[model samples]
Target: MTLPVDLETDAARLRAIMAEDLAVRGVLDDPAWRAAVEAVPRHRFAPGFYLPGEERDGLGLTVWQPVTAALDPGRWLAAAYSDTTLITQFDGDEPDWEHPAERHGGAPTSSSTLPSLVVRMWADADVREGHTVLEIGTGTGYSTALACERLGSAGVTSVDVDPYRLERAASSLHGCGYAPTLAVADGVYGYWPEAPFDRIVAACSFRAVPPALVAQTRPGGKILLTLSGWLYGYARVLLTVSGDGTAEGCLLGGTVSFMSARTHAAPAFGNPAHWAAELPGEARDARHGPERITAATEEAFHLRFLVQSAVPGAQLATVGDVVHLVDVVSGSAATLTPDCEGGWRVREGGPVRLWESVERVVDVYEAAGRPGSESFTLSVHHGGQHLRHPRVPCLPLPSPEGRPGRSRTASGRTGHSSSQLARE
Candidate 1:
């Protein structure tokens, strides 16, 4: 049997690391933030075991230590202190204590987000004392603890979908002497029991902001969340609710990946083999227009965004002068191989194919001057029913210059595909 690890020593080291980092980063200047960071013992919230190398090093290196499979206090402390995500689930499921190995497989479904990200989010939300806040995604209850520390337990309400996670987190919070109302329900809907929140923050990422979250907040209340997109990174947006339940916030900075809430989870792509077997030979070598088209430009960025928005489950990859689009839904992955002088050939079943729906995006970009991200505008319409930004008027097809055409289209079309969107 594995022995239990010591918590006190580990907590001290973690405290030292966090304090040092905060001091160096100038985050320690905020008394409230500093106090919360110091007071929270991250290990208490991580009850399940984690391998030695599982922790994030914060320098683009992920060390996986499987030899020491069971949780260790020192390792846990370091992991808790680092600015990296600690995986809490595998294959859309949480860890099963009896089967420790099962915890490591598949994509991480949940985690106590990195400390830096959490702190940054709090900064974005502008959390203040006495403010009533609703926190979405209560993984390990760490962020909820911070909210509690900042706003007091009575002032914060947290919601999550997994009852087991909620129950475990409740115990951890109680053990640490902080108790907030914990609800085991979908966060996308927002907790109506604590409606009219002065501030709303989501630790999880959403493909699109749910109407319910906007409606539940009081006018002038702010909503902070990581908005998932096709780009390599996500945009953290901070919008304020209007009296009419509409909210608009600017994209803050950078991105982070989070598990999609159950309500917004990506649909599973059918068998890969099935997709590989269904390609027509002649259709495979379709023509992709020009080399300048795939080049990144502000205008081209808008075209790319349109393609991503239109096609659900499509992933873009640039390989050795060739661009590939892996369609998760149809199980068809296409590759567009650029010919010698910037022209290209489409390869179905590969990453990019010209005639395929994926290459159409490249054609659109080539048509555009390849503008940067600054030139576009994003607008949400349908009574705040949809998010259409960067691309004008939210139309499906591109204009002659590869820019999104006019808006004012009909209200509802179910928005973008959930599969292509990632949570942060």
Candidate 2:
């Protein structure tokens, strides 16, 4: 028979090693944070996580196998301490934290984010000793515990849409002997009871900066989150709430992606042939190829972000060498096919001329000399929020460009298909 192992001793050693890696990699320069990183046991928060197994899901996810400390102390402890993301929720289904599962196909619904990233974002948000923070997406509550360590549990308020998530987080946090405020509420609205926070940091991504977050943040305070859309493009932004009840800042250069706010989650995309059959749009030769916006190349990645920025609710569908862009709301749609002459043919219809507007944005992007996201700024003012280069003309929000429908707007989710609308 195998003898039982001392888990706490091993966990402490792993924590020390993880802290050392962060410091050496420049992710944990703050001495206080480093202390917290070493002291807080992430394993207590995320005792089990899913790892990709032999099977694969076509959506770039995979067949995940659950690992828990009770089943395999060594592997579970290793995953808990690693610098990578550990999924705790699988496709909205909770993982069995004390059991082992060999394989199951599912997308990631929630996770313990990468430790390095967690530390980096906290540092970027400039979390300090006296700051009262509002943490969006409690998830595994690991980051919440980290903040509690550095700033004290009294100053931290965490919120999640799922009550079960909050329950687990509260339990795990209590296990760590720290009790920060945990709430079950939609993060989009911002936790009002704890208004005027010194820092509001999000683990989940949003289509735009939450207006409620702007109002609840004290003037000159910071709000950090990743902005993403159905196209699956992402941009990390750090906005400072101004005295004028507005916030604006440049996009952080690195790429960061997150699952949608459940309220904003989209459905799996389906065939566009039926949609095209319903709306026979005007036919014309197109100057630009839609392939440039959908390709997986790095250069195309930037363009994909720009296109998603320009058209918030548009969904992509590819069929038989043709690419389709459909705006679910307004019923606008565009289909593009490569022409025999090395050009592209297009058909677009509805309240908005989808392809025409896309071409215009691409034109403006090129005219601006193709500035990287670092040079681009995100402005959220009384009029509306817009992401664009300062010197360049505004990238018009959807409302002004076309008529509104029931589709998901930047302000909130009317909802759509993640498969159809969201890029993998």
Candidate 3:
């Protein structure tokens, strides 16, 4: 009863709208980036996605329903061209084939990342005409397509841990007339076969730059990755590898949280018995005012980084006025509560005196003028990587204070649990 819609005209209109939005915000300034954005047909990559409904469910939960070309082609194409992230995969839950109309609920495991963020990272990587770019975490292959359009398909190499994703991406890339190299491998190790890459950009986040990534990069090559911690705080960095095998760079201002690399994810959290096993190790009292670091504000960004650098693998969860800190590596846990007086009380356990370190680091950071990301620089060595600032003292990457023998996956490779990792 209905004629086929003119997809090209519709896609072009939406692309222009996206470009205008980016230009007005001063994000699409690079001619190459602009050309790539305009040329690539984003709708080809995301055949189906979940869009969160404006209304809440009876239980006050956000409703996310799938939209596909068969269900609603026009709306689907519009969303594909929008600037928002499109959810492509849900973790932990599988679709119910019996109830085809049912909507599944779970954490978003993969997605088409926001276009602006992707371009920003590409810009930071300094991807140029003749540069060979190795893109880690090739979700949906949208970024790979962009790189292929900007440079040549021969200059782009993309790798992802999931073979299923790589297969889908390959089809999408081929559909768009791009045949960039696609590999099914762990991004943590980077692709050694494609070594000496001029530009390396990771769409995923990790606590530290993998030494292998640095070794595979050509001298003076640039690397960009979202530097994230278990605290869930993150910042972007673009480091230039030197002949000495050290890459130093400053953190880009503004927060960015990507799915943690699969190999870097932590094990099961929220197991009551897990915490119960370590509660009898130690007990501690108030060390200092937790508000000096726990208060949520723009200024607290540096303070969060301070705690992450000091404690290594600390994760934070706040309930009411109390902040809970747990380290899977060290089995250390601490509960910080605001004291009636303007100070704070700390109850600690396990081998690590996390509260004492927090107090000491806060003092040092404050004395150093509470430097921001601009003052922070990364120094990646073969042994480890440490974040340093001119004003704040150098903090070496601490041993991942997690439980030994619990970090590796069944494949006998170093891998984290599903809880601590995401791919999209």
Write the residue-wise lDDT of candidate 2 on 1-424 in tens digits: 1124577788889999999999998889899999999999888888777777765667644677778766777998888898989888866877555555654556678889989998888998988989999999999899999999999999999999988888988998897789898899999899999888999999998777778899999999999988777667777899999999999888887767787777666544456886677666457898778866777666566777777766666778777788888876555678888888888888876656577767866777788787788887888888766766665665533332122224453435443211112211
> Best by lDDT, which number?
2
Question: In candidate 1, which residue ranges exceed 4 Å CA deviation?
Answer: 1-10, 26-29, 49-71, 102-104, 229-233, 276-279, 283-307, 313-344, 347-378, 383-424
lDDT of 3 by residue, 1-424 (tens): 1225687788877888897788789888998899899999888888777889888788666688887777887888889998889887777243342232434356676789989988888987888899998999998899899999999999999999887778888999998899898899888889998788999999988777777788889999999998666665667888999999888888888766788786676555685345545565444457566666556775676577656666665677766677777777656677776766766666776556566667777777778877777778877766556677766667654332222222544455542221121111
lDDT of 3: 0.75
Q: Rank the candidates by TM-score, best first.
A: 2, 3, 1
RMSD of 2: 5.7
| Deviation (Å) of 155 in candidate 3 | 0.4
Instruction: List model 1 lDDT by residue over 288-401, tens digit each.
Output: 443333445433433444455445455556545655555554344655655566556665652223234435544444455543333432333343233333423332311212
Error of 1 at 82 (Å): 1.9
- lDDT values, one for every candidate: 0.61, 0.78, 0.75
Question: If both were scored by lDDT, which would come out higher, candidate 1 or candidate 3?
Answer: 3
Ten-residue region with minimum lDDT total, candidate 3: 415-424
